[model samples]
Target: MTLQPTLPARVEKDRTTPPRSGPSRRRDSRYEALTGYLFVAPAVVLFLVMGLYTVGYGFTLSFAKWNGFAPNWEWVGLDNYKDLLWRDPVYAPRVRHAAANTIWVMVAAPVLTVVVSFPLAVLLNQVKRFQGVLRSVYFLPYVTSGVAVFFAWQYILQPDGAINSLLSGLGLGSLQQPQGWLGNPSTAMPTMIMITVWGHVPVAMLLYLTGLQGIDRSILEASELDGAGWWRTNMSVVWPLVRPITAIVLLLNLREALQGFQTFLVMTNGGPGDHTNVLGLEAYRLAFLKNLSPTLGLASALGWLLFAAALVLALINLRALRSKT
Candidate 1:
């Protein structure tokens, strides 16, 4: 009985339904965009004021000679850059030494970190009991206070420190360093490299562990079924799958090595005759530690040079990764 009017009622309802207005939709989109801009405005303003402005100011300052309290910045043109290159004899050798040490750290630290951390990650991944506890333990040093850790390490590497004590107890007293690991020119750089590697291992391990967990169990099982041993499977199959993670770890390690000087500063202070000097420490010394004769211009120039080197190396890394892909 109701079917008699159903078709007419449906048609009427359809005709009466309001069409979506283009202006309304456009307004809604604009509103959303405005809201997004408002939310991000604070961050953008802060970056421009704090980061970009300071960077630009530093670049300008790099072209001028300025003691920290000078009434006016003395225009020096490219003199600061030239000084770092070869012009200033005192500055030139220090820069060269720091540059060499920086390069060594950049290359050695990342490689050692990767070599040490990946295996630890694999082992940790296989752990079934107290996995969380073990992971926390490994990561603890990374989260600990850097100054405290550096001091602890400094104590540990001292002449009569625990390491030498242990060496003596093991009847390897001949191998012990009486000058302390950090004080000896021969051992200082290597010891610093090892400490850098140690500091980075936890991060790399965590990354690898996450990557390993994300891998398909079926692929692993199939590899085992195909008579592949653990090492073989991991090296051949697992490593390839975890290349992305490896890249991240390598980049982070490289950045840290290139930019970090805190550990060396705290532990060695570029001592043993500049054996552990790095670019970052040199820059810091130039900028702040010069007392009344602050070479802020030279420090800024060095900072820019360091930035350029880091950019080049990072670009190379990215290019290599892309080509692999």
Candidate 2:
């Protein structure tokens, strides 16, 4: 090598020095961090104001007696909770009946909805044409106003309504006979359960459809190549893959069933008796609708009780379902 050109000492020193990201780069990084914080600030403020503040206030209110209009709050300590839980005859009965009805709906609605939705989702996934239209039709109830949907179903389930008429036309004359589906205490809860299942199926189906789309086509093909039939492949391969989605669907359904109020309010008003009463409706009645003893404190306490139950149930459900997976 022609004697390597003698490198200038200044050039060599320059080459050896690491580049400094001086004050400007640091300033730019600080600017980026500030922008990120600015972007998140509104959401943080909203949660603090609307979510945390309201929850805190509600918790505090639960221990005090205040008719929402009262200028002063009277501390009752655990009296409100005790009354709802055991002491007050009127409040306790309502709570027990409502809690039982709520449990029934919570158990039945999710099971029935999943039973119906899974097959519909499978069929929809197989359809190659007009799939979007079909999906929209199925999903319409989910996007519709809940009050409107309940009103529509209220009409359909009436004694002389479309369901009865259809049953009559199908020669199920005994079943079509006047039954007062929403008015009769014996039939009201079951009718509500059916409507709840129908309303919830579309959402569960949509979730299942998404899960189905994410399944590996190659695995399905390999299952078929291995002489696995449709039912077998679905039961063995597809079901396992979608277990997480099932868990989500179950949690959502349970939450909705537990907190359901509007449908009962509109359709049956909890009843010919407290037949369709639920904890959410009971809380509302205690807080706002009772002509006698409108106890906001008790209502708040009941609300917190329901919240605790929901939280515990949700955790149990997640644990049970996830552990299976």
Candidate 3:
């Protein structure tokens, strides 16, 4: 038996060993490249890490009753969420008010921007001298800080802010009077919306300008040859071409409006009352302002709900764009 086994030891070993080839080696290299690409995917990697930390932590915190810095906390299940939804009177309406304000901002910012900016862009485009300078000057507010910004605007809107100052010069009503530009409920939302629009119009103008530059001169010439007036050309030619840019500008404005905490925090702090409250400001109050005990659960739930709404809106926009295309 030993002799029979020893007859072809090399052959037996060769039969037992696995085989390797050029194609196999090449396949192995490709496999490695695939994994390497995944490792280096900046966006995917960043999303995973950031999402895991933010979304996961937020979700976890929602179920626990944690104070600002205290390590001692208890599992509260859906209690916080229930409290925000129905049980707690203060937080419930605050969320509703905040949502309404956010919607106003979202609608007002971009629409007002389009109304104010399109003409400005056209005017600026036509100008030969200091055009770029004017555009830059207008765009300054987009890059400005919210902290000092609100104060300036507050003064202007103040019983004696800029608007008041001009009004007083013109012998109009005083801004410093108890008219409640910010303090009163009726004007608060509108005031915030105007602020939102004023701050964002520059961005809309810039994007519209960029899109306008991309319009073919030949197309405009052709439209003019077809007896199209300025309005006709805009509706039939320029507007259609600039649709994508408009959508993008609107999307940006919507995001900003939905995240409308800065305006609330700086100027109104969600109001002299809850007049300017939006979900964003309410979330802030629940999470940070109210107590050492955070309403993380409700905040997270509200955040997810808002995110879902935004996603739906975005999808709707995308689908509409696709249909147009």
TM-scores of the models, in the order given: 0.91, 0.88, 0.81
- Candidate 3 global lDDT: 0.78
- Candidate ranking under TM-score, highest first, comes to 1, 2, 3
Ranking by lDDT: 1, 2, 3
Clashes of 1: 0
Q: Which of 1 and 3 is the better model by TM-score?
A: 1
**Over the stretch 1-325, how does candidate 1's per-residue lDDT look in tens digits?**
4555445434344556586699988999999999999999999999999999999999999998888898999998999999999999999999999989999998999999989999999999999999999999999989999999999998999999999999999999999999999988999999999998888999899999999999999999999999999999999999999998888888898888888999989999999999999999999999999987849999999999989988987898899899989
Q: Which residues of candidate 2, in runs, are more than 4 Å off?
A: 1-32, 177-179, 291-294, 321-325
Candidate 3 residue 92 Cα shift, in angstroms, is 1.9
Candidates' C-alpha lDDT: 0.93, 0.88, 0.78
Q: Could you say which candidate leads in TM-score?
A: 1
Candidate closer to the true structure by lDDT (higher is better), 1 or 2: 1
lDDT of 3 by residue, 151-259 (tens): 8888777664566566668877644346547766778788888888888888899988888888889999999999999889887898889888888888877877776
TM-score of predicted model 3? 0.81
The lDDT of model 2 is 0.88
